[model samples]
Target: MTKDEFLQFLRDPDVCKEIFEIVKKGGKPAVVAPQVQPQQKFSSIADKLKTVYPNANAPQIQPQPAPQIQPTPQPAQPPKNNAPKGSGSLADKLKFLRGHLDKVREEEQIAAAKAQEKSPAEKYTVISNRRCPICEKDTRVVKTKSRINVEKRDLDYCIHYKDFDPYLYTVLTCEHCGFAAEEKKFSGAWPNKLKETLREFLKQNDMKFPFVEERNAEDALSLFELAILFSEMTDQSKGRQAILNLNAAWVCRCEGFADRERDFMEQAAVDFEVALENERWPINGISDDMATYLCAAIYFLINEYDKSTTWLGRIMNNANLRATAPKLFEQARDMWQDIKRANKA
Candidate 1:
């Protein structure tokens, strides 16, 4: 019991009477060991002799060893899907990719105005050289430093910073081959098929990814486009597509581009839903419950109340979900209530 509970127990009249009666009987504490039993007291030479001479105890029946289990031969796993799923080849997709540089230039002036005091690189970000996985060429990559002051976090998992937008450095681009992707996926080993596909994609499209010591908002936008384009053209997992779109939405939100942000959010919701319905479990390292919540949250953000409620209903109707994931269950329930209030309004 806790200290407060013990104090309360001592203060009770009936408990005090019981304690006095226990003391009057001179009873030992519960921790004190009981006297030994008679059966375990067989320490004599006769007992040792009886163990050696098995005939003295009984006719011996030897114990048999447990049977061993041979491992069954398993079927070979299926090869991963690597075929292109986009509308056209990588070159065609690149030709149609949205530049959105008009909005980028608008935001550029705002950022430039702010940078007159102090630039983001002077305090928040640092540059380092890393070998590009696809190109095998060394290129400059931007990295964020710690202790960034947070302004707020939205329910959709977007973080707003007070001083600088750290996500501007999210994507790393190679200057030589024009290959661009997120930093985490930039260096890890890729399947030979995928590596060949990327090399071919770069070769097919005459693109150039020039080095940028300090990434402006437009550079960040272009990197995201390339990453998402790469993912789609290579038929990467739907979950990864959702993540890129979601992050792109946040980046657009940082630039105050509401329409583009909504467009990205809509894509994010669709990709997450596709991942849940058709793709495998533990989609892109995210739990099914979290992906579900993301779909619901994104729908809510886009004012699709019916879709949001439908996804949230799945969580609320699940009896085992509350016990298995209490925190997520509560979040879902709260969102359900918020949807109710929103509908009423």
Candidate 2:
């Protein structure tokens, strides 16, 4: 109420006793309903407490606002991702970007390595248009600019190369009609009768060509075999067929196909004898003397010593061989000596 009224009430013994009980309770200070007193009258709180508890031995009870139990000061927690700006989202974004950049770099390295690994033969080839006689379609003819190093030339005309072999690409494959032949024959003139036979043969079968540009040893051999089939239907010279088979056999040897190599060599031998008897001399760039020599070489290679010696005897006995072609005579003489030695051994 009024300050004068409050002072009169504090003077009463029961009110003063109640306030004293609250202040004297155990533990920290206990708060009671605060009675407003005039500042001028209640200047010293100790004087009032002493006045209230007069004669009894009372503990000094000073008026104090209740002790404020402030919550404990806790240290701030760091972000789980250890972000600079204390944000996990920014850290996650940076991690994703770094991973993406690494993947990009890996793909680029693979691309560069593939480019570097391209074939060496691609640089030395000359591309020219060649018309296929069988199919009447255009096939690209790829030939080497020049011959590579000649390591050795064998009797059956297989020239071993110290570098890339152009013989592997000698066969021109027509992608349209599956007609494959040597670069010269593939583009050269063909008889109308042979063309008609091939046309009839093509009508009965389905064939597709699936190669271009670069060819592995295996694919080139496959093309050679395909050309052999096409060669038979086209009435290509037996000598020419024998040469094709010999070249294919050489390729087989290089590729480690021993069984197929021997088989082709045997076919070449049979065809060579037929070509010599039935066809004319200088057949398919091979002279009659050369054909006889190849027949001997083929028989020798296949271990047909009887046929080999019989064919070799012809070249050895021919009186005009030394005068016309001394090199053939020399090779023939050397081969005969070798065959006699082989048979004796």
Candidate 3:
């Protein structure tokens, strides 16, 4: 029993008398202790009294401390897409190719400009040279003329010197294409060797073609041929090239303002559009497919919904691409949906 209840019981003369009588009768009552209602009522009254007047001088009651809380562990999340804004891994490589192409075009333009400055009637000196199989004897070496060919057309100089002088023979032929050239007088086989050396130098310094100038205005058929050639040359480096292209595009997209961003997005769109024009199908390989999906994702991030949707659709529409890059496709679709919902909201 509580201390206060016991004290109350001690204060009651009637309760003390009954307890004394029970102890006097050898601690046994006629009825069982369970049937004792009076004692139970008295005990409850004592508990109430104790609450009303808690004895501060009496034993102090200690409260149980609250239960300790354990932190809930969270699930680990997957890595976020760190690729650039509009291009995928392949974007940078394509950009690199574009740079090379730009260099070639610039060189061609300079050469063309220089050629234009020369008067058509201006007499160009010709020198004699030995008979090369390509040009034959009596071939005259003259200034290089612009011609359309896959290899160095603008940079190549024509031979027209053999007719000018006999002793100072200087004619040379292209090793690969058998294109003939003639050198100025006072030059012998040295001209031929120099031509070979120049050819080698040009080959070594050959720059990659820019995407815009190389593929621009080209029809689907022409693009396909170029793509095929590029694929053959790229081989294992294709993935790396894609990544670099993506990086460059992403940087450009990020730094651009509204109009710039729009322009970048347009350019990105143009790339995929060209790819589609050429292939008319998703890229065959996994690495290529992933690269393509990355391109789509970049478009989405830059808010180019239509282009992004088109690219995603291309993958989803194609049974093979869809099956091969299911996760990538799903991610692109989900991100696109989120963008739509956010815009609506």
Relative to the true structure, how large is the alpha-carbon lDDT of every model?
0.78, 0.77, 0.43
Candidate 1 Cα outliers beyond 4 Å, as residue runs: 1-118, 281-285
Where does candidate 2 stray beyond 4 Å?
1-118
Give the TM-score ranking, best first.
Answer: 2, 1, 3
**Tens digit of lDDT per residue, candidate 1, span 1-345?**
479866875676544554554464455321223454555554644543334333333333466998998999989979964333564556554544444455678799998888686676768888888898887888877788887999998877789999788888877788888877776677767777887898898998966767776777778878888988887777577887888888888989999989988988999999999989988768446788888988998998899999999998887888988999998888888888899999999
- What overall lDDT, based on C-alpha atoms, would model 1 receive against the true structure? 0.78
**Which residue window of length 10 is worst by lDDT in model 3?**
151-160
Against the true structure, candidate 3 reaches a TM-score of: 0.27
- Would you estimate the TM-scores of all the predictions? 0.63, 0.64, 0.27
Question: What order do candidates take by lDDT, descending?
Answer: 1, 2, 3
Candidate 2: C-alpha lDDT: 0.77
Rate residue 168 of model 2 by lDDT.
Answer: 76
Compared with the true structure, what per-residue lDDT tens digits does model 2 show for residues 1-345?
Answer: 589867976776654655667655632233332454565364354446545444323454677998999899879977664333533355576986788789999999999999987364775667777777877888776677684777888767788777667767878777777777887687678889988888778767765566477666777788788778887777767888888888888887767789999998998998999988898878557799998999999998888889999999999899999999999999989888888899899
Report the error of model 1 at residue 264, Å: 0.5
Candidate 1, 192: how far from true, in Å?
1.1
Better of 2 and 3 by TM-score: 2
